[model samples]
Target: MRMMKMTVYFDNNATTPLKDGVKKAMAEALEVYGNPSSVHACGREARLLQDMARRNVAAMFGVRSEQVIFTSSGTEANNLVLRGYFACPENLEKGSKLVISSVEHNCVHKTAVDLNRLNGVSMHMVTVDRNGIIDIDDLKLTLEKGNVGLVSIMHGNNETGVIQPLDKIVALCKEYGVRVHTDAVQTAGKVALSFKDMGVDFMTVSFHKLGGPKGIGAVIMKADIDMECHTSGGSQERNRRAGTENIIGIAGAGACTEEWQVSVDKMQNQIGPLRNKLEKGLKQLSNELYIIGESTNRVPNTTNVIVPGLEGETAVMSLDMAGFCVSTGSACSSGRVEPSRVILAHGIPADEALCALRISLGWQTTEAEVDAFLAAFGEMLGRMQKAS
Candidate 1:
């Protein structure tokens, strides 16, 4: 039987395809050639567009419009929170500690490392369970050690799709009088977020992950938390972040958030069935396939499966050539062939860690695409089995 030809995309956790509405919104904004900071009618028009974008994003997080600060990307947002917070005059004292989870994205991990190297800051890493969730007791033990400046925990594990117990962590932080900062990049649009309810001191989100344009993101800070400005310039973002904003990208992010608010139910319905289909097909291909974090609560559209005796990079390449897009681990470090830190953190052997692959579905992923992937994936696995 001849297999059907298809171009299947399953790397939404890396980045998503821009929606038509978001593209249209960005195109419309691009026609307005005016700096938002200039004192003129054109500038006022641009400023209005920017304000609308802020309000749209704020609505998604249930925060005030002024509380959201736009940045170049999620990395910049993470840097601003990690570096900017400790650099503030109020927090510039010695012996300040910063705690982050073991499975954090490189943006968070590298930022912490850089701060420790340069600023004499104490960096603590919170351990995670086999399910990729931060061990709350360990976090409390770390918090009790000293004057904890910040607690940076991710809402969702980008690699394993495990959702952390954020509310419990936040409550514990409050009891200890510690400030919390959550990297909600992966969970922003896919899961429900309420700034008022989450009660974290700061939160970061990226637009590219949510079907919006790249190079634009937002950091939501509590109104009272005084963070030093990372980029100093004219009074934009209420003097929180500097530089003329990417107006078109901001507009696109706003459109994406608005559309998500209205169509979340539809998206949930569409992606869940496809994820289940992929999981079932992969398990049938080989019972030895270990699904990491399967016993824990995970995002609806992400699956991390370990194929024994096969290198993840080789499998990823084979699948890519077969017209299926997936990932070995973090897309930021995809070029490297090292075993994933996320998989290793789950107590998987170092050699076994090299066998993990992550397949994440998204809005444009269809049933036909998933079916095509299964057929190609089965063939690929059969070849690997025979060679081994």
Candidate 2:
């Protein structure tokens, strides 16, 4: 008789499990079927739910509720800012360039490409170092060239968990009077975040990356930023985004955000130690193993490991067979045969990038589970190395 392997989840950075409070809120919201646009009693109740969610999300970001614009996903939120901000005639004036980091999520990178290809907008990509941190000098030189309207960078990388020096980046951009945007999807609930402190013009976050339901994200814009509306329909989201709000997802996000500080404390106090333990165990398992961004300041729950002589997809399969859930890189970029673009952007060779694995912890991860995963990974790697 074979014993069943206990299921272990280490892919929280891809998408986290919904918290109990979020589930309860979403369940209650499901009963609210009335359209928020209508002025009847039912519609008023629906609108109240959305309004409450809006307020809760606003409180998490330390911003006014009016500054939060809900969108379908983080990708849509990023597009709204990149596309909508550039849509303004003033921003699109000749020679006005959009500066982005080379390691941005595909949403930001692809959108920048489309903006350049379709709209004839100028784009400059700042490179990153081996640790996946953006080069501050490259950014400063690009801004010095003049004609930059906005600078978009991610707060913490989803794949490598590397945290960028937003203070330095923001301060430099401020000196040049250029707008800045950061995708904070992976950092919002896990780290202490202050919109006012970061001093960015716009920030994007996805609820599902935390404990909220999917299909809902928010773009936190500074009060003074003038961005044109991309989607035109209803007057929802203060006319910034025009669509009937997703009440269920919003309710979940609201409940999740209401307890944001608690989650941050847990991540820092609980998950960080577990991640450190996993990294130490992985290094001890083999001298050939490498942990990406290990020395850099990274998110508490994420560890990106490079296992020599093994492909990430193969390891993912073997781990799945052993009842472990992990990821090769971003969930958005999964299924492609190519290596991670984010890793390649850091000057890592494509072959090494293909061998990388991202393990992200969460609120419920345990020491025993981490140890078990280490054992399983070690065994699988030994077998793969022998075969190679």
Candidate 3:
């Protein structure tokens, strides 16, 4: 049986298809050929382009130009907030406590653990419901325990497409006088984010997730909050992050963000219907296939299905053979054979978590691709089950 490979991409959460506009903007940045740090005309021009991109990225979050501090990636941005925030001399001595949601991306969760092990910082985790929504009541109770300096929650669950109720969490954190940060890497361009409205002390955004180039991201924080520099040496990014910026990647991200803001609704309109069609198709596949967070409000582009009687990695490989790209968890962690920690955090049994497959849509996903994937997936699942 010569089954010619038919590629259908459903792994946008791992990384999106590079947008044409973003590529063009990044190409233009190469012509500016000046050190953003230098005082010469070329340097000044580079600086101008960087600032313009910074302002545009900030605007994506409804934030001020000064608040967006560029970093190497969203992981770096998360590290800056978690580590940099505690690196403060006064705060370090206080034995400050930081809390993150149980289902946080590895960057946030691992950083918290490292801070606890290396710096002796106090850390806590607020649990989430089975649908992967942050347990607000549990969070309030944790805050009420007092001495919690910062609470980090992600705006969207990459695997499950579950969006946290950040407004309520922010208001609760404010009441407790604890700083709050959100890993918004998965949500920024996919949904509307109002920095002024959600009112968290810090937010992390990634470029690749915006359908832009990788290797660049930014942390948008309030004006009043100050942290020791995450990276030391020359003063760049208002003495916050100290590295020569990724001028090209920043330019691409800026262009991507701008394009998203203009056409977000169109993207969603296309994504929503296709996602619904896919989900409907999955339901028809078998009664045992469960879409995690099916009952809740999920970001339009993601679906996590627990295919019983199949290993997540097995399903991923089978789908790959069938010409569909999907994942078991965050791309960073998917290479390993571990069950999803995010799924485990939701109290799903380890076995079920190991069987979960995440299918994430993107701006460029077409109905034909969805239809193709559904057909291939259903066939693959049937074969896998028959073998069992």
> Which numbered prediction scores highest in TM-score against the true structure?
2
Per model, how many backbone clashes are there? 0, 0, 0
Question: What is candidate 2's lDDT per residue for 1-388, written digit by digit as tens?
Answer: 9967449988898888889999999999999998888899999999999999999999998999888999999999999999999988977663368999988998999999999998877899999999988899999999888899889999999999999999999999988988999999989999988899999989999999888888999999987766888888988887788988888888898999998899999999999999999999999988989999888999999998997668898899999999899999623336567888898898888888889999999988999999999999989978977887
- Report the alpha-carbon TM-score of model 2 versus the true structure: 0.96
Kindly report which residue stretches of model 1 are placed more than 4 angstroms away from their true locations once superposed.
1-6, 93-95, 330-336
Leading candidate by lDDT: 2
Candidate 1 lDDT by residue in tens digits, 29-140: 9998799999899999999999998999999999899899999889899999999999886875633899999899989999999999998788999889888988999989
- Among all windows of ten consecutive residues in candidate 2, which has the lowest summed lDDT? 329-338
Model 3 spans with C-alpha error above 4 angstroms: 1-6, 92-95, 330-336
- Residue 349, model 3, lDDT: 88
Model-by-model lDDT, in order?
Answer: 0.87, 0.90, 0.86
TM-score of each: 0.95, 0.96, 0.95
Q: Per-residue lDDT of 116-139 in model 3, one digit per residue for the tens?
A: 999878898988888988888888
Reference-based TM-score, model 1: 0.95
Query: Which pairs of residues collide in candidate 2?
Result: none
Better candidate number, 1 or 2, judged by TM-score: 2
lDDT of 2 at 86: 90
